[model samples]
Target chain A: MQKLGDFKLPQFFNYPPYFTLQPVRETREKQVQLWKELILEYCRTQKIFVIGLEEEFPLFSNPEIERSLSHEAREAFVSALVSDGRAEWLDKGHRKCLILWHRIQDWAEIIINFVKENGLEDSVMTVEEIRSGIESRGTELHGLDRIILMRALKLLEHKGKLAIFKGTTADDEGVKFSI
Target chain B: MKEQLATFRSQLEEFARKHRNDIRKNPAFRSQFHEMCAKVGVDPLASNKGLWAELLGIGDFYYELGVQIVEICLATRPHNGGLINLQELCNLLRQKRKHDREAVSEDDCLRAISKLKVMGSGFEVITAGKKKLVRSVPTELKKDHNEILELAQAQGFVAVDEVERRLSWTLGRAIDALDTLLDEGLAMIDDGHEDGKRRYWFPCVSSISSVGADS
Candidate 1:
């Protein structure tokens, strides 16, 4: 029931060894998997689109035990995520990471459902509207990461579900749903 | 004297035939019967050809129990990194077979372990202090390793300072043993502490189970 800003942390977060990278092969494999699942779940619920390796991520530290992951440990964990395709390093030095908590195809499904529910199946709406408009408010789409949304939209476009075009203003960059 | 011995042997055979069901179904009775058979230099579970074997079918019984033992060992191997206490294993086995009529004794569990044909040098029962540990992995643990594991039985972990102070050993010896255990995946390290003392924890010897939704 430990809380990291309303996100319930797993019990192992309090374990000191969990903060350190395990040297044993089997133990390290299990530890890496737990970190991957925790990172993904945390980002999904907290709506965190990116993780900075050098920045203060709540899950990486436990104040009760005064334990924090070393820089190498943090990089190792995020590297595991990168290998799994659940996350990506945004830079060559591997500083910042883009968290893809949901797969691109899944985000596309959510967008299609939103279109159907809002009666915008054949309508044209700005890309910004899909992210910030009142129509998308109170849904997962609200305040969604621009990069992930754009990727999902591009995936939908390639599948012939939608089309992208320019408008009068950058804010009005339009996505036309032909569904 | 030979006639008296024949009388006693026939009596034992008769007794086994009458309580054959009880001997198989009850752990206490099974252990007592096993002791009696051992005392008389007769092993009903030794082979499947004789009258004692035909009457008790004890060979097959131990064989079936061995399969269940192997099943529990394999399933919980990850929990303790393939090393577990013998008593804990028996408790888990009994819990697993709660619906069955046959209650297993520790002696029966030992017999079951011996009965398993698949167990080669990789599997063995080793003594750690007063307790017996069932090791499913092939890792060869030294006496120093066992001593560390025994010391860790209380708190689930041992700091190097603690190991040094308690065992009256040099710091280098303690570190060498702990490092070997670490390399074997039998011990996990925790360098995070208030005083910055590095610790080595053994899940196999530690009684405190890790509590989490998905451990």
Candidate 2:
């Protein structure tokens, strides 16, 4: 029943060892698998793109249990996600993690679906507008990371589904969809 | 007398060969057949090289079920710490084999588990209080540990005082058993409760499994 701002946490979140990394190989592997799943799910729903190792992220600590994950445990978990291609460490010291709940390939699919649904195909949209414009206000593309969005756009452009045009500023960069 | 026994065995084997499909398809029929075999002291599933085995092919069936049992045990070992309730194991086996025509009874599961003894000392069916538990790990659980686990079955957890008061044991005996289970990774500690007493939770015998397994 525990919730982090309407994000329901799993029952095992209250388990003390969930904070302390397990030493047993089998137990630790399951624990890590569960943590990876919960992290990705929470991020996907909350639209969280980044996690700071040193910061007081809500999921990293449980006030009800008075237990918090140690720095080592945090690094170990996000490092696990990084190796799985679900996340990436932004710095050398592993201080920050960029969570890719949806892989880039999946993002491309979402983009195409969004264009088709919005009847925006064969039309033009600026790069920044797609990120925060009224059309994308309630969609996943809204508030999306610029790097991931651009990568998806570049991927689509390479496939001849769209064309990218230069603009006076990065925000004004335009994309014309041929699909 | 020996000649008469031989005749009976051959006749029973012939009957089993005829009803092999019924034995494989019906859980109730299979249990009754196994019970009947037990009464006559006829080893219908003991060996795979005999005319009886070839006639029924039930030996391979049991072996296949044994492998599935091992896989289920290993997959759930982390959650239950290598121990699982017998009925629960059977339920999971049935779920895993849902596509098959046969409904797997607990008796069938027990027979399959017996066939798995050759794997090692790791597979065992031990009685914890009144409940039967299948222990997949080679970890030796003493009588006190079994009693502790039995106590934990009620609430999925036990505190030192609860163990001492319920089992009428001194504090030393309870702590020793709890500590052993904790060392085995069979139990987890919870010290965050409002009462401040450390509650030892046994996941193996506990009825409640974790949620959020949804994709």
Task: Give the winner by TM-score.
Answer: 1
Q: What tens digits encode model 2's per-residue C-alpha lDDT throughout A1-179?
A: 88888898887787665676765566677778889988999999989898999998888988887877889888888999999999888889899888999987788888998899999999999999889888888888999998789888999999998999989975689999998
* Full-model lDDT, candidate 2: 0.83
Superposition error at A164 for model 1 (Å):
2.5
lDDT values, one for every candidate:
0.82, 0.83
Docking class of 1: acceptable
TM-score, chain A only, candidate 1, equals 0.94
Q: Model 2's CAPRI class? A: acceptable
Using DockQ as the measure, the top candidate is 1
Q: Output the worst ten-in-a-row residue range by lDDT, candidate 2 chain B.
A: B206-215
| Residue-by-residue lDDT tens digits, candidate 2, B1-215 | 88887787777787788899998888899888888777777877889887767887888889889988888887777766788888878877877788987788888888888878865746999988778888888999999999998888887789999999999999999999988887777877665465768788777775433232122
Q: Taking the candidates in order, what DockQ does each have? A: 0.46, 0.27
lDDT of 1 by residue, B1-215 (tens): 87877787888899999998998888889888888878777777777577877888888778777877777667655546778788877877777778887778888888777656344635678888878888878788888999998998877789988989999999999999999888777778887776787878776765422322123
Clashing pairs in 1: none
DockQ of 1: 0.46
